[model samples]
Target chain A: MEATKKNSWLTENRRSAIAAYLFISPFFILFAIFGLFPMLFSFYLSFFRWDGLDPMTFNGLDNFRFIFSDPIFYSSIQNTFIIGLLGTLPQIVVSLLIAFALNSSLIRFRNTFRTLIFLPYITSIVAVAIIFGLVFNNQPFGFANYILSLFDGGPIRWAAEYWPVKFAIATMVFWRWVGYNTIIFLAGMQSIPRELYEAAKIDGASIGQQLRLITLPMLKRIVMFVVFTATIGSLQLFTEPLIFLGRGLREEGITVVAYLWRDAFVYNTFGTASAAAIVLFVIIITLTAINLALSNLIGRSKRRVS
Target chain B: MSTKEVGEGKFSIKKFFVYLVLVGAGLISLFPFYYMFVMSTRLNREINSVPPPFTPGNNLVENFQKVTDSIDFFGSMWNSVIVSSTITFGTLFLCSLAGYAFAKLPFKGKKVLFALILVTMMVPPQLGLIPQYYIITTLGWLNDFRAIIVPGLINAFGIFWMRQYIEDGVPYEIVEAAKMDGCSNFRVYWNVVVPMILPAFATLGIIVFMHVWNDFLWPLVVLRDPSVHTLQVALRALNDAREMDYGMIMSGTFWATVPLIFVFLLFNRLFIQSLSEGAVK
Candidate 1:
């Protein structure tokens, strides 16, 4: 009787385990269908030559080879880095400063300012991009040029010029993102004990000195998180450039993902787009790894100093 | 000597400067929206005038009509509502279900499976676009609402976020008691766990809604039929076709963004509270 009861208990436990799997099985099923299979297929497609509808011809390594030799590809890579650097670096700094200012006792109406700043972030990118297109229009009467003309500047052909187009897109990115990073940094700053600042002030430290010594050091982890997240976001920069430059400067403002989209969908060069995507993926992973390694190194040094 | 007095005077000066900077920043932040709204009410000629229209004009109705004509604005809006609402509802149900399982249930491979789910969060959606497109095409799902809704129903981030809240907020003993009362596991999850995790549901729901509502790329890729396009996609079409019609485009853009603004204002407190709480963890 004891043996039978123990066996029945084991069966009951097994039945519940089966039911639990039934409940959570959707994720695995969906992942297999949408996530894993596509990734593996993309890898396989990278080594072929096919215009999406045609038979994919096996062309091992040719697409990758072409990617290296293509000047446009190199330029796109250069543009990606420049835009990423221009967009992410200043955004992080400005966000940190704003976060600090808001955290300071000197400021008032903190929540209002925070909400206003964050509004741009939550706004639809398409709307913002369109608004910015008008603002940056190369016409003599464009908003940007009109403002610049006040300072005795000539009307700039923003879209026609390559660097100007990149700069315009970067500005939009900055405008939309700085507040988001500010909010994140502000959260990080608030978590730092007020006693740290109190003690620093007691030792006759100036506000700037306290920021440099206490705020910066304590925010290292959050900064790393911000950097890595921003790096990934920057690598995949799309819609802003797409709408800002429009159809004329497709190549000029072509981000990597935009390029991938054009190749895959517009030109139907699915295989090559897959290859480019694979390379882009690899670059992102490498950069993230480097960021992690650098953060780790900095973290260790900071720990030793403390 | 008189160091305290000097320090107090300097501190007041610093406070004055701080307010100046804060107000300036606030103006800069709000100026774009002002410009957008002002431009939306101005005609093309007024918009292009040498000085440009700095104030709102009386072209709001005209621009609204133009936007409606340029794109099926109502149709696209309805599509967006349907798609975003569906995704939000699906995400809440599926994520809450999986989150509850991971949090309360004692199941085999629960730890390993949850870890696997978390790993997907790191893989950028862009990486899978090519193959996902292929799969969608193969399944004949292009332009189908299901194409947009089904694949993204149970996202990893939602599940992870829901799990985090469930783990922290929901008590496992309550679930045990429910089970002891001859309730099935599903019943325990539904009656006991769901009610307790409403705040988590709200947070995840808002995030998911905002994302789906504003999503441009996937919708742009999958939906080829103009009739089936979402608001963002329709706005893109209008933007491309009528680059010169600042009023119409702005009006359309304004309409597209207004719902989000409403949602943000409505849930502003919860939004900020969740952000701070999530960041702390």
Candidate 2:
């Protein structure tokens, strides 16, 4: 009887395993075809010179060497970092403040504010870029310049000028993303226990003191999450700048990803584009690792203190 | 008594400052959409006039006509609908199936396979664009909708999200009970597990739809024929044609953004609630 029951159980388990594999087979098949094979093939192509038509010639490390010496490659990198910093720093500080304000008891219609702000995030980036392009148009009647005039200033060439192009792109990035980070930060803020605030208040902590002592310290993990995502996202910044600067600005604000797209698709420099992409991937990974280590250290120290 | 009064006065002043900052920030956050809507109604000359019109104009119908002529607005809209809907349904079904397997079924090498899926998330999509383009071109699938819809059907993030939802939301006892009733493994998942994770399905559905609808780069690369172009790519063609016509471009943009705005307004609260809850995990 025991042997019969054991055999039945084994048979049942085998049947379930078969079903499970059948269910998961689609993902495995698709990933193998589209995801894995393409990745490996790209790595292979990185070592060869191919222009999408002719037979690929093995070039070894020539592509990498050429990329290193290329002036346009360096400029693309500089533009990406400058735009990333300009966009990311203000976004972080403003999002934290917005999240803090929403978390406070003094705010009215809190949910309304949160949802309204988050609307920008859900709007299509292409649409956002198009709208901002018109607003930043260097014409005499441009909305931004018109506003500047109200402040006793002349119309600024918002898109044509280099610095203004960076500012315009950064502004769009900030507008679209601030609400996303705010929502994330609000989640982090809500997770903090109410008793922490009460305890701080009893100790005669002022509002700013409580924010510094109780809020920021508790928000370390959330901050890390935001920073890491924002950093990775900044590295891959393409669409907004591509639309805004590529069309409105003098093509001088091309991001690294945009540059990659132009080279691989437009210019057909496949090998060099692949090399640039690989370099970007390495930079992103290194930055993410540093962020993770720093966050982990901070988390450990906070745990010890508590 | 004087010190206490002083403290109260300072607190009120700070509170006023906080409200002021919040209001200012909110306006800045919302100003672009406001501007887009305002610009869509004005004519080209009006848009380029000094001290541009701050309010809505009466030229909306004319601008709409130009927008339609510049791009096949309805056809591209249909294309977007078809593509986004197909991908969303495919992702929901396939991802849920895989997620169920990872969460409930005890299979050999499951841990390793799950880890592999996780690692794929870190590999940026741009890295594979060249090879992917070649593959599609070689297979003669360049202009086919399947090129966009199929490859992205079962994404890593979707699988991971569904697994997370299943692990937390569904009970193993239900599966065991279904088995005792002589139900097949597929029957258990189809009848029991899927209903339990409907909230997750909705959240994932919205995100996937939005992404596929707004996607520009891949469609631009793969689909060259105007008939095969999605809405964003079609709109880009319009922008290129009348590069200097701010009114027509703004009108096209305004139309492009309307559907999403409508969807968001209808479900914005649900989205926010789900997002907040999802973040807790």
Candidate 3:
């Protein structure tokens, strides 16, 4: 019986299936322990209140209740959107322009230019935040201040107040990511048919007109992708604010993720942190779904127009 | 003839403005980096001075001493290397194995499993922040390097990238020929599929390595120890200790950023290709 079973298992389909199982086991195993378990535990923890050390006491809707009344949480959501718009809007436009320029025939040394522009993305964000902190140091001799002095403007508190803190973080976000989006746009542009551009040129369309009529419409899907992804990323903005502020859980520059970090680790309010994480996660999913729906509508409308 | 000449002049002027814009954008991207390098060399006083020295300062040795004196800089970097390199190689192995199976092997549930993997790739992994900490501490993995490394080894994106690459690049005829010669599935993958996908390996290696190297959020959570801290984590500690000491923080940042920048400069062609190819858009 054993011999027959072994022989049966040696069939090609069974053998390949076994091999495939072995090959794919690592990801499943790791994912179970790391990704799926953590996500489930996070959701589960939202219902019960537990510090890192003590046993969990079951609390019904307390975490959610607390979040609703927390003024800081509301402001963090507001600050997050403000920073998101400030960072993402310009990044999209600027990177789009750069990608267009890089694609045009007038540019030389394209590879060199591309490498230099992408340099910021590769550096550590901790480093970027620290560097920007000093550059925008609200002192007489600071680089930003010196530039301001040239225009008779006094030193601006780039990190002290609410708006400047958001501005500083937004600038950091824009700096690190603009090149990445530019490259994406460049790839999207490259994927378009050259014949379209040739046709536009033959039709006496100038560069700006060609860009408006052909390129932007063609890039709708990619633009939606950028918007949704940037929304998700901006919602989770943590490191820059954390480093820039140099204080634990300061009110001025706290993002939702930063707030989550403080509640769990600083205040040992793990349940509140878990609730906030879930809230942020829900927002991200909703935004991405909306973006997808809008993009689909535009896609269909364009198809109808054609 | 005169009208055409005027139009040509106008076009040249527009081209000049485009170049100006492109060059300005490039400078803005790089100016912070230049500032980082310059500030790293200056003392606190020099950085705080009225003229704000643009040139390099002679405080290099002092700041280097101050940084190492405060933090376990080398140990932290070694931990970062171990984490990133381990994840890099692990992703290459596991991702390729699964990718090859998905693309080449006639396996049961291939479509279902591959679809699940692709689905996971669509969503961002930012949901379980505090809960992740709970699980990590429960597993008694706090302050452990494995906490950072093990959880990070498997990524759906890496698997997707490998599958797409293998399917597009690797021909089926050779895989069939190897199978006909009585090679087992694993051997066929090990001997034939991997060699054919070297360029894919390089691109994936760089990407996986870059992600692991630059990963801050997760590592910041688990790596509470100074010894096991990655570069970014360590730099955070260093900056906090020498708070407002621009020289020390900048020097640390400069050194921490140098290795990846070095590698990037060397393999820019491969590096940029990976970025563009791996772009979600």
Candidate 4:
């Protein structure tokens, strides 16, 4: 009887283990085929020279070397950083402030405000580009220009020139993503214990004082996370510029991903596109490492100060 | 209420300024959308008028007809709906199952597998565009909705999220008791585990729904044919291929945005709470 009971227990354990494996198999199977394989294959293709249709030749370091000399690739990187910074820094600061306000008691219809603000981010980017195109139409009576005219600034040619194109893209990026980060920051703010704020209040800590002394310090990790995500996202920036330029025009607001798409699809240079993607991958990793180190330093310094 | 006096001396000009800024920012957030609605109603000729009709115009019906006729707008909408819902439901099922296993089940290599999933999230998928495209092409999934939907159905983030829910929301004692009663693992998950984590299911559902709807780059790559084009892809095609009127394009924009706005409004607090709660602890 004792041996039979032990045998039944062993069978149960084995059966359940099988069930657990079965449950998780789909994700692994899908990831293997779609995610991992493609990623590894792209790395291999970066070292080869081939258009989409042609026979590939194993060209060692040629694709990377070609990109180094490519002026458009360099310009695309410049545009990416320019647009990323223009959008990200303001977004971080503004989002923090907005989150602070929403968390404050003075604001009424708080949920309504958040919903309205976040609405822009959820709307299709294609729609955003198209709508902004009309507003920034550069004509004398264009919506943005007409608003500018109030300050005696004539039609600013919002999308016609280099800087303006970056500004336009930046503004679109800002409008779309600011609310998202605000919601994130606000969430972080709400999680801070109320007793601490009450204690600070008893000690006559002002709002600004509390914000600087308590809030920002506490939010350092979340802020870093937001910064990291914003960095990664901006690095892969593509669609807004692609459609905003009306498809054929790759001159203004072209991002790295946009440049990649154009190269792969327009120029049919698969090897070149793969190499650029690898370069982008390296840039993302290095920036992430830098950000991680900086955040760590800040975290340690704050701990020491306390 | 007591917060109003945190730093300020009394109810003064500063309070007024704070409200002003708040209201002003809200209006700025909404102004583009208002402009979009206004342009959607008006013809390009009227849209270009010196004071560019700040108010809604009467050309909505005409523009709607023009855009729909230029491209298969409704067809694309149907395609988007199918793609988004399929992926959302599929994700909810698959992610929740895997999450339960990783969170509750004692299996060999569980820790290593979870670690691998975490690692995958760091590798940005867009960087592998060429080879991913080749994978789709190899499988003959080009111009197929599955090319977009299938790859997206099993995101690492969703699995991580669901695992957190299962670990926190469901008690281990309950699973043990169910098993002692001779209940199968899947049955325990379906009856007890699922009902307990409905909130998680809803949050993940809405997040996936919104993402799949707005997804562009992948769909643009996969759907080569017009008939199978997702809404965003089809909209781009319409804009580039036709000499579209500004009103018509705005009309398409309005059409794409309205459904999401409605969904968002209904689930605003649910989404906000989940994201906040999920992000915080």
Candidate 5:
């Protein structure tokens, strides 16, 4: 009787295990075909020259060599970093301030403010690009130029010029994402214990001092998280610049991803594009590692100071 | 007492300054949407008037007509709806099932599988874009909805998110109890586990819907036919073709944005709470 019961339990265990596998099989199967295969294939394709029509020729490291020697490739990286910094710096700072304000007890209709601020985030980037294209039109009658005119500034060519184009694209990035980062910061702020603030208050710490000392210190991890994502996101910037400057290569505004897209789709150089993608992947991973290390260093230094 | 009163006055001034900053930021945040609406109601000439149009004009109906005539505006809208909803529903079902297994079911290699999902979440999807497009072409799925829908039906992030929610929201005792009643694993998932996790489903569903709806790059790459273009793609075509027609372009953008904004307005609090919660997690 005991032997039979043990065998039945083993059968039931096997059945449940099979059932569990069945449940999760869809994700693995789909991911293997769509996700993992594509990733591995991209690495393989980076070595061979193909134009979607001709037979692929093995080129060894020629694709990588070509990209390394390409001036456009260097410019694309420069543009990516410049625009990433332009967009991310203001976004992080402004989000922190807005989050601070919203967390204050003086604010009424808090949810109303949050919804209004987050409105921009929900809109499509294509729509934003279209609207902002006109708002920042190269023409004198553009809204931004009009506002600049009020301040006795010249009507700048917002789209065509170099710095202005980067500024315009960066503005769109900031507008769309500021609220998202604010909400995240607000959540991080809310998680900090109330007693810390109370203790600070008892010690007569002003609001600014409290934020500088207690709140900022307490929210280091969340700040690093936001900065890390922003770094990665800013590197992969595409749609805004793509829609802003059209599909053609615009030296002033073309980004790394845009360059990759152009190479593969427009130039029909899949191998070079694949090489570019791998390079971007490495850049992203390296930057992420650097960010993690920097955050850790900051944490350690702050701990020593405290 | 006099010093305390002076301190209170200073505090009120600071508070007023804070309110000023908040209200100003709010208006700036909303200005673009207002501008879009205003521009949609004006003709191109009026849009370019010395002082740009800040209020609605009588061209609202006219611009709407122009939008539909220029491109298949409604057709693309319908395409977006079909794609977004199908992907949303598909993701919720598949992700929730996988999440449940990872969260509650006892299985060999569960830890390794879940770890693999987490690692994929870190691998940027853009890395595989080229070869993924190639694969879609090879399978003859290009220009078909399946190209976008099938690959997007399940994702590592969705599975990871659902597993986290399930582990926290659903208790193990209930899973065991359902099994004690001789309920099959599928039945437990469909009947018992699902109802308890509606909020997670809603959150993931909205996220997927918004993502697929707003997606521009992949659709632009795959869907080449004019009739099959998604709204984002069609809008891009319109912008490229009619570069000077501000009113018509704005009108297309307005209509494309209205459905989402309306849904957002109706569920404002839920959207805010759930999104912030998701971010925090």
Candidate 6:
């Protein structure tokens, strides 16, 4: 009887395991076909020259060699970095301050403020770029220029010039993302134990001191998380510049991903595009490693200070 | 006594400053949408008029006509609705199922699978763009909604998110009890787990719906045919490849944004709460 019961139990357990596998099979099957295979295939495609219609020819490291020698490739990287920095640095500080202000004591209609601020995040980037394009249009009657007019400034070539193009694109990036990071920061702030502030208050710490000494240190991990995501996100910046700068307009706002897209679709250089994609992947991975290292250093320094 | 009064006065001043900052930031956030609306209501000539019309004009109906005349605005909207809902519902069901299994079931290789999902979340989807496109072409799924819907049906983040929720929200004993009562693993999940985790479903649904709605790049790449174009792609056509009428573009932008803004207004609290919760985890 005991042996029979044990057999039944083993069968039951086995059945459950099978059911579990069956349940999760969809994710794996689809991922293998659509996600995993393609990733491996992308690496493979980096070696071959194909123009979507023609038979692919094996080119070995020629694609990589061409990309390394290409000045446009280097400029695209430079544009991506400049725009990423222009967008991310001010965004981090501003969003942190916004989150801090929203979390302050006795704030009214906090949810209203949050909803309003986060409104831009949900709006389509296509729509945003379109709207901001007009706002920063090259015309004298452009909305940005109208504001300039108030300060006795003349119309600026917002789209034509390089710096202005980066600035315009970065502004769109900043506007769309600031509220997102703010909410993340606000969430981190809320998770902090209230007693930390109460204790600091009793110890004669001012609001600023409490924020600096307690909140910043405690929220280091969350800050690092925000920074890391923002970095990766900024590096992959594509649609805003694509739509903002419009097609066939060269030498400005051409992000790495945009460059890759143009290369594959416009120039029909699938091999070179794949090479660029791999290079971007490497850059992202390197940045992630650097970010992780910096975060760890910050963690160590905070520990020493405490 | 005098010093204490000064401190009290300082507190109120700081409070005022905080409110000022919050309200100022709120206005800046809102200005673009307001500008879109204003621009949509004005004539093309008035849109570029010096000082740019800050208020609504009498040209709203005309701009609306121009927008509809330029593109199949309503058709693209219906397409967006179809693609977004299908992906959203499909992702919710599949992700929740996988999440529950990962959390509750004593499955073999569960640790490795879950870790793989985590690693998948770190790798950007763009890394596989070329091959994915080639695969779609090879499968002859190009210009078809399935090209977008099928690949997006289940994502790593959704699976991870639902798993975290299930581990916290669902109890182990319940699953065991259901099984003890002759309920099959799938049956227990269908009956017991699904209802209990409706909140997670709702949160994940909102997130997925919004993302799929606003998604531009993949749809742009795959759905090139004008008839199958989603709202975002259609809007881009209106902006670039078609007409240069600012009034029409603004009107299209205004209409395209309305559905999301309406959903957002209705579920503003849930949206905020859900994001905050996601960050905490």
TM-score of each: 0.95, 0.94, 0.95, 0.95, 0.95, 0.96
Q: List model 2 lDDT by residue over B1-281, tens digit each.
A: 55445545657776676677678778987888778878889888888888788899988888889988878888888999999999999999999999999999888888998999988888878878888899899989998998999887868888999998898899999888987777888998999998999989998888788789888888988988889889888877776773577778888888888888888888888877665555444
What does the lDDT read for residue A65 in candidate 5?
99
For B1-281, candidate 4 gives per-residue lDDT tens digits of 45656435663564666676567668878998898898889997887678779899899899889888888999999999999999999999999999999999888999999999989888888877888888888889999988988898868889999999999999999999998777899999999899999989988888888789988899998899999999999888866755647888888888878888887788788876665555454
Better of 1 and 6 by lDDT: 6
The per-model lDDT (C-alpha) reads 0.83, 0.83, 0.85, 0.85, 0.88, 0.88
List model 3 lDDT by residue over A51-167, tens digit each. Answer: 888899889899999998999899888888999999999999999999898887655788988888888889877888888878778787888887889799988887778888788
Pick out the ten consecutive residues of candidate 5 chain B with the lowest summed lDDT. Answer: B1-10
Chain A TM-score vs. truth, each candidate: 0.93, 0.92, 0.93, 0.92, 0.93, 0.93
Arrange candidates by DockQ, descending: 6, 4, 5, 3, 2, 1
DockQ metric for all predictions: 0.55, 0.56, 0.62, 0.66, 0.64, 0.67
Give the range where candidate 2 chain B is weakest over 10 consecutive residues by summed lDDT: B1-10
Q: Residue B194 in candidate 1 has what lDDT?
A: 90
Instruction: Report clash pairs, candidate 1.
Output: none
lDDT tens digits, residue span B1-281, model 3: 55445445657876787788789988998888888888888889888888688888788888888889888889999998999999899889999999998888877788898888877765556666676677778788999987887878868988888889889898989988897677899999999999999998898898888888888888888899887899889998887874568888888898888989999999898888888778751
Q: What is the CA-based DockQ of model 5?
A: 0.64
Best of the candidates, TM-score: 6
User: Model 1, range B158-241, lDDT digits (tens) per residue?
Assistant: 778888888889877787778667678788878888999998888778778877888888999999899999999999998988
User: Which stretch of 10 consecutive residues in model 6 chain B shows the poorest summed lDDT?
Assistant: B1-10
List, residue by residue over A79-194, the lDDT tens digit for candidate 6. 99999999999999989889998987657799899999999988999999999999999997789999999999989999888899999999999999999889999988998887
Each prediction's RMSD over C-alphas, in Å, is 2.8, 3.0, 3.2, 2.1, 2.6, 2.4
Model 5: per-residue lDDT, tens digit, B32-94? 999999999999999887788788999999999999999999899999999999999999999
In model 6, pairs of residues that clash are: none
Error of 5 at B228 (Å): 1.6
| Off by more than 4 A, model 6 | A1-6, A299-306, B1-10
What is the DockQ score of candidate 1, to 2 decimals? Answer: 0.55
Write the residue-wise lDDT of candidate 4 on A143-212 in tens digits. 8888888789888877668898898888888888988888899888887887787788789887789899
lDDT of 6 at A86: 97
